[model samples]
Target: MPRTPTLSFDRGTLILHPPPRGKSWMDYATWDDRVEKFRIPAIQYRQVVEALQAEGSYFSDEAKAFEPLELSPSMEMEPYPHQSEALAAWKLAGRRGVVVLPTAAGKTYLAQLAMQATPRSTLIVVPTLDLMHQWYAHLTAAFPDVEVGLLGGGSRDRTPILVSTYDSAAIHAEALGNRYALLIFDECHHLPTDFNRVIAEYAIAPYRLGLTATPERTDGKHSDLNLLIGQEIYRKTAADLAGKALAEHEVVQIKVKLSQHERDRYNQLIQTRNDFLREAKISLGSLKGWQLFVQASARSAAGRRAMIAHRQAKEIALGTDGKIRILADLLAEHYPERTLIFTADNATVYRISQEFLIPAITHQTPVKERHEVLTKFREGEYKTLIASHVLNEGVDVPAARIAIILSGTGSAREYIQRLGRVLRKGKDKDKFALMYEVVAEDTSEERTSVRRRGVKRSEERGARSEGKVTQLEILPTKQITYGSGDRTSQRAAESSGKWDDNNSLETEE
Candidate 1:
């Protein structure tokens, strides 16, 4: 009998001894000149093993050493219809796929269900410490008998079930690659980024699950999730669950105009920025235009000034005084209602917090303080919370029915996540969820507003009313009141008339 090829783990890669020559493995297997053997990334351990087995090639394997996991019966919780549907779809996809369910739709619970089904050593990767801790708490509570580990936020305990931040996972993916049999990515849409992609590619987990409310990215890198984790096996939008699984909802757009002095400064700054762009022959319409602008800004004083002007123009447009006034009125109109206010930048969030005396949570907020703020908000000690991008994903606040988008980017994912913060069904069965978008009229924000709403510019115009709020009723079964010209309604629409049919405002010129 001849000696058959064998596979073994070496550092972060797999070593193939008596390397298979003149075979299909040649495509992925590379000659390790130093070791005098073929090497493959540890991630391909399972793939190569299956291929060799299918080809009737006998191979001894020692790459995977993870322990099998068993879910305690106490850990099981009855899942909702949609959650069950998502899990069924994932299982049908060979337990390696993505689940696209709106936020607060119990995506985390679905992950727990997956753990029970797979019953193997698992690693859950999250994006932020807030999420890492959140998962750690949930996992520890659910699986009391199982030893859960953490690999982020200064913690490096490894157990049968593990939770880690993307940064930490990327830093240690190789060593942990063959340690888990299952991998779960929360908010998996972020997995396609430059360095983070290594976490998925370096893991040898045979089973994978990706969860996200919105899997589409502006950079189109989300498409890579098809291979990085698996295909999107199930998807449900906010609309798909409204009134049944989620609260009934409405989206209101209130337009406002800038003060005269502000408009003058904005126009001047935009003109200055455009002048530089024209002279430098930089067209922002191109894909690489922003990159070009960044590189150019680093090389010349003129470019630096142009960059400052650009920032000023955006601030003036996105943070207009008139919008602040509108926010005040909306806050009053929804007084006593649990509200979440979202802004484009931390400065704006802090400004709102200071002016309104509301609690603010930014990345700069200490973890302990942030937790205290969220706890108070949940306990009704605080009726409102203001944040810039930090609360857009995974924070569950079911009591919140009002969301005020003072300012944000045009990304649909951002808009939807913010909306989802308030979409969770509450005890009030008839409660109507509301989201107010205070947009600056005749500014670059108009286009952004349309983009964020995922509506066509022409359709938006068709529904437009001069200075009046445009209300979109998301649930067909629900009827709510925001009459066109009521006193409070007028207050909401005051000065909005200037937004009339003009749509040519440019942030650059």
Candidate 2:
């Protein structure tokens, strides 16, 4: 009888001995000098096993040291139809793939169903400490008898069902690679970056699931999710769930002009920066051009001055006095409703917090204090909450019916998430969720606002093609209007949707 091939776990990979002759697995396996044998990436464990079995070859499998799990956790509520559909799609993909659903669509419940269905030793990776604790509490409640552990947020218990932060998982992936048979990446878009990629590739889990509201990344590495997790098995935008699952919502863009002094300062700073770019023949439009500018700036005094001017110009655009005035008026108008105020930086967040006397939460906010603020906001103790990038992703605020975007980047992911913060369905179904994007007129922010809203249009088109409709309305200034710097809304909606800069809002199907 021919010798049965053996497999063993190496450093985050599987070592295959004797190189199964004439097998198709040779395409991915490489020779390792240290072991004097063939090495296979641990991620390929499923493919290798299936190939060996198809070839009728016996193998001693030791790469997977995780024990099989059988769990039937009780649930208080059943999965919704779309949630069921998402779960079924993931299952049909061989229990390994990504599911893209907008926030507040019960992704956590879908993940819970996956855990019950697979019933394997699983590790869940989240982006923030708050989310880690949230998942921990949910899992512990769902699996009352099962041993659940947390690997982050100053906790280091290891149980069959474990929740960890991305940082902690990245640090301990190698040691914990063979300990779990399933890996769940919450907010999976974060996994495709440099250091986070290690956590995904280093795990030996054959069963993987990635969950995200917006998976599109500006860096274009989101495509790598196909290998790191699996192909996108199912995707549904917020528009797809509106009215039925989520609150009816509308995105409104408001353009405001900087004060005279602010405008003068902005123009002067922009001129200084533009002169340097013109002299260096560098374009800020492309990543490479921007990178070249940064390199040039680091090497000379003129370049340093240009960098300073650029920063000042951006500050003036994002933090103009007009924006603050508009924000105050909106806050007063929406005082009866729960609101969320978002900014791009902590400085602006704190400024709004102080000027408006609203509580703020940024990365600098202590964890306990952050939780208190969220709790107060949830319990109606505070109606409005201000945050920078911290609340853009996961921390839930279900009561918010209004969202004010004072400042942010042009990234569609950021825009979508900020919009999602107030999209959760509430008691009054007839009420519309409102998003207000405040843009500085005629400055670089004009282009930035256009780019961000362009992202929304792309998603709107994508959703429309998929048989869902979302509305975008451009609201003209109630008091001040300099110029409609970018008329994208008017042009893009000309054929199908009409432009309504007037106060009359249009709700799409």
Candidate 3:
């Protein structure tokens, strides 16, 4: 009798023995509303893999297996009975939905518990590459035996369980959609947009899950999430997450008066612009004239540079520098093992990192280097790290004893991401610290915050509304039952029983 072998795709579909791969998976595989996502055939995957391996790629089959860092179930994970109950609820929800637990409420741990309870072909999608690696490390530890693959940071694998960056999955949505039985979106609020909507539309995996500290969308398309991806199933706010499994933190809003010199400079610009508008008869009516006047002020290269400098100077006068000093002092006072400070601009992050004795992290960081920096920070080699937007959303930093948001809130998305930074729970008493928002008296940014925060509040209230429906994502109901030993080991063992041998790794198409 001929022995049949199992086959899988980027999406995690299993065939007892699929026919020899045919077309490039991109043609019929897409599920775009306007233009569908692409799908590649199994033969395409095999060819790509072989080609990359021939080139001696880093992720090739020739690459030796990474040493396993196994986690004992008793040591790191002890799912609270309540958390387990939520997992049970999640299972009953058909494994499709979002869990909105407040900052520091142990949401990552919740995800871990869910993984343990409903282990299957899962893909955890995160917003940043830092998070991509963070998830990879954590999931690898949780299910050490599973042949988990990574799809961002220049690495891709065909393992049953995978962790990927939002951009990577979104970019390759058509090719990867049909491969997974389960999909988990972290910082799920960022979904249903340019980065995630495509993924939602293409992949037909039966199970889905999204997690966020704040589930409100920045682009005003959460309803799209409701329609496209899944529903917001459960929510627990920071006020609630605190004192539960999370830390009890304080928020300090420090306001700094603009320096006299900077105030005069600001006044000059405002006055000049105002006078030009009046003289040019462009009092918000003549759009062309208004643009011309502003352009005239920016005529000289020096003036143009000065205009930018003025804004930066005003920003420093208003908050960032003063806030930096304050942060340094606070870090000294608390000496938190892991503290993260966020800035709206990259320059601000750089200046703070240079001036203060803290490390900075951003998207520009190579994936592996970022891993080393964070690992060092986590193990207490460093006490503080500065971030520009990157740290605001998805990378799990359970060691973040304190978080300081020195700037931003332009969009509700910004606010949510910044606040979510400190929410990962630590050991001990789970004490958490969060210092958020510094406004310049009556700046437009302040007004925007009110609107965004209000909208967030409203949406939360509607969660109990029967008329207004929230999204609930379906997760795979079928658990990875009848498997023993570690996940990675099990997969390696499965390799011996399967049709493919030493061909588990995936290559780019």
| Candidate achieving the largest TM-score | 2
**In candidate 1, which residue ranges exceed 4 Å CA deviation?**
19-27, 295-305, 426-431, 455-509
Ranking by lDDT: 1, 2, 3
Worst 10 residues of 3 by lDDT: 500-509
Better candidate by TM-score, 1 or 3: 1
Residue-level lDDT tens digits of model 1 in 1-509? 56667777776788888765437566568887898889998767667877887777777787787888778846675677899999999999988999988787778889999998899999999998879988998999999989999998899987989999999999998788888889999999989999898888877788999999888887889999988898999988777788877887877777676778887998888788778878898866534776777788888999999889878888898888887778888888989999999998999998889998999999899989999999999889999999998999768788899999888887777888998999887576676799888777557787777666666555554444342222322221111122222233433433243432222233121
Compared with the true structure, what per-residue lDDT tens digits does model 3 show for residues 238-267? 555556665665554444334456457655
Question: Each model's number of backbone clashes?
Answer: 1, 0, 34
Q: Cα lDDT for residue 1, model 3? A: 42
> Cα lDDT for residue 393, model 2?
83
TM-score of each: 0.87, 0.88, 0.64
Using lDDT as the measure, the top candidate is: 1
- Which of candidates 1 and 3 reaches a greater lDDT? 1
CA lDDT of each candidate?
Answer: 0.80, 0.79, 0.56
Off by over 4 Å in 3: 1-76, 115-119, 273-332, 335-338, 364-369, 430-436, 442-509
